[model samples]
Target: MSILFTRLRHTLLPRRNTVARPSDRIQVALLLLLLLLSLAAAAGAILLGAGIHVVESARSVEQTASRYATTAVLLADGPSPGTVGRSGTAGEPGPARATWVTRNGRRHTGDVDAPAGTVAGNEVPVWLDATGAPAERPLTPLAAAVDATAIAAGGWAAVGFLLWLAYRCAVFVLDRFRLARWK
Candidate 1:
């Protein structure tokens, strides 16, 4: 058992002649720098990816809201009321309120009220739920533009980070090769 342990120790220990060469110092420095650069770039890329994900999620929500929205014309010229009413029974008539016009021009009358933004004679977009009820509010063009800009920025940032990482890796490899040749 002692002999076996001695053999294992001898195998694990490094030989004196295997010590790093003079040129290896520069190689080590370059490798350290490369590792740092890689870490920094990875962090930047992760941040960019997260930003992109947020933008995409916003976009998806907007798209889904738009899909669920119904097209309606204002019955009277005024802002929509904040409260909306549901369909009444056969004997009970629905509340007196504005009606929504679908894409097919089908008039659906209901007491469901929307926020005051639409005016009579003005065609506005409105979202409706599965129960044929209004759902989402209006979206401004500025909001959409901001979302697009965020997505673009995130994509560009990710690309820039990857390019920087590539550059650092190339420089590290070239430096290591030069040092090896010098020895």
Candidate 2:
């Protein structure tokens, strides 16, 4: 492994007692610049992802803090083929009428997504907002982590692609110039 690395390192360095071609030098410089830019972009992407995660987590905590969880009894059968979401996809949970009691002991009835074929009187978990209305569950920590990682990876990949593109274009132009000079 060490020998392989030394060989790789030596391949990039100018050999002694020989003059390197200007075009080769320019290619190497552009490659190094691309590497630097990729590193900088990775750092920036990580920071942005971290900031987003922090903000999202804080908001999740704040929103879920006052909200409480309880069970809602289904008031009807879960959505059937005719009552699927707008896209009309099957197998996905669909909204069904339900009733639940809030943290303040107030009773309320509304719609909640329950698994297909759920029958009336079946109990399902429900999240209630501060106003004591049924609401979506708060964002979980796993979701925040996944969101941050995806954003960071996407940002880094986009920057890396642009830098690579720039490097290729520069090398292409340099090669053409060198060819013209040689002719």
Candidate 3:
């Protein structure tokens, strides 16, 4: 890494004896500027990803606190006819209507995605909020971490790509200028 840094430093600020043209100086400056901005962009992407993960984790915590789980009895077989076309992979669940009673002893009905192979009269676990309304399940800590990492990596990759493209264009222009000068 130190060797790489030394090389980069030399490229960006070559020895005075090696400097021959104004265009070389400009190219070095542009390269250094682009490298600095790319580093800033990568840092920004990490911060952005952390923010998203925190918000998502807080939401998940809140949902977990407010939601309760219970067994819901399916009302129809094969996840209802409407969901037949929307079925996911071989083992994924499809949408269905189910009924469940909350802690207060009041019965409620709602649409839920039941596991594949579940049939009418099968009891499936469901999540409900304090108001007896269906609620989204919370994400596990591992899942949140994975999601944040993936988002950060993708964002960083995009920034790197843009910086690389700009660097390429700058080098192309500089090469053309050098050729013209030689001519």
Candidate 4:
């Protein structure tokens, strides 16, 4: 065992007069910088994605508010007969429009398209907002999970970069020390 240990140490240990090369330090530095930049890029991408999600959610909320104010109703009834040939056009009301029965028994026509497979008398939520928009909802769990993955990847990259930097620095310092001792 002692002989094996001695042989292993001898083969692994550095010899005298071996100096730390400038190229080696440069390589380490470059690797560290690359890792750090990659981490930063990942973090930035996550932030950008989150920002876009927030904007979309806000737009949905605004639409929902508009729908609520406009007293819109989901056409519980199937599409009207005349709506068969109707093409959905912007600002053009279709014949298949659902009527919103207000509390006063007054009915108002809404511009929302009926859901697919909806039969006559299927109750759907009515939006009363003026803009006919739906409210924004929070990000889905899947989206949040993706963001979390990005964050974790960035963290791992940062840790790896730091460890690499420490290792390279230690190697350089030890080499210098050994060179000095030999002198």
Q: Rate the local accuracy (lDDT) of all candidates.
A: 0.57, 0.84, 0.82, 0.54
Q: Which 10 consecutive positions of candidate 2 have the poorest summed lDDT?
A: 79-88
Q: Considering every candidate listed, which one attains the maximal lDDT?
A: 2
User: Per-candidate TM vs. native?
Assistant: 0.34, 0.85, 0.79, 0.38
Q: Which regions of candidate 2 deviate over 4 angstroms?
A: 1-7, 15-19, 81-84
lDDT by residue (32-141, candidate 2, tens digit) is 87889899999999999999899888877887796778999999988665455656677568888999888778889889888877889999888888998877888887
Regions of model 3 farther than 4 Å from truth: 1-10, 80-84, 87-92
**Residues 47-160, candidate 3, lDDT per residue (tens digit)?**
988988998788767777888888899997644333434534455677678898999999998787788778989999888889998777767667777788889889989988
Every model: Cα RMSD to truth: 15.8, 2.4, 3.4, 11.4
Better of 2 and 3 by lDDT: 2
User: With candidate 1 superimposed using the best TM-score fit, by how many Å does residue 118's alpha carbon deviate from the native?
Assistant: 40
Order of the predicted models by lDDT, top scorer first? 2, 3, 1, 4
Task: Give one digit per residue, the lDDT tens place, for model 1 in 36-126.
Answer: 7666765665576566566666766765655566656656644324433243222221222467865555678655443354455545556
> Per-residue lDDT tens digits of candidate 4, residues 20-96?
35544454555566657766766675676666556655655555444442334454554544444355533332333
Candidate 4 local Cα displacement, residue 120, angstroms: 2.7
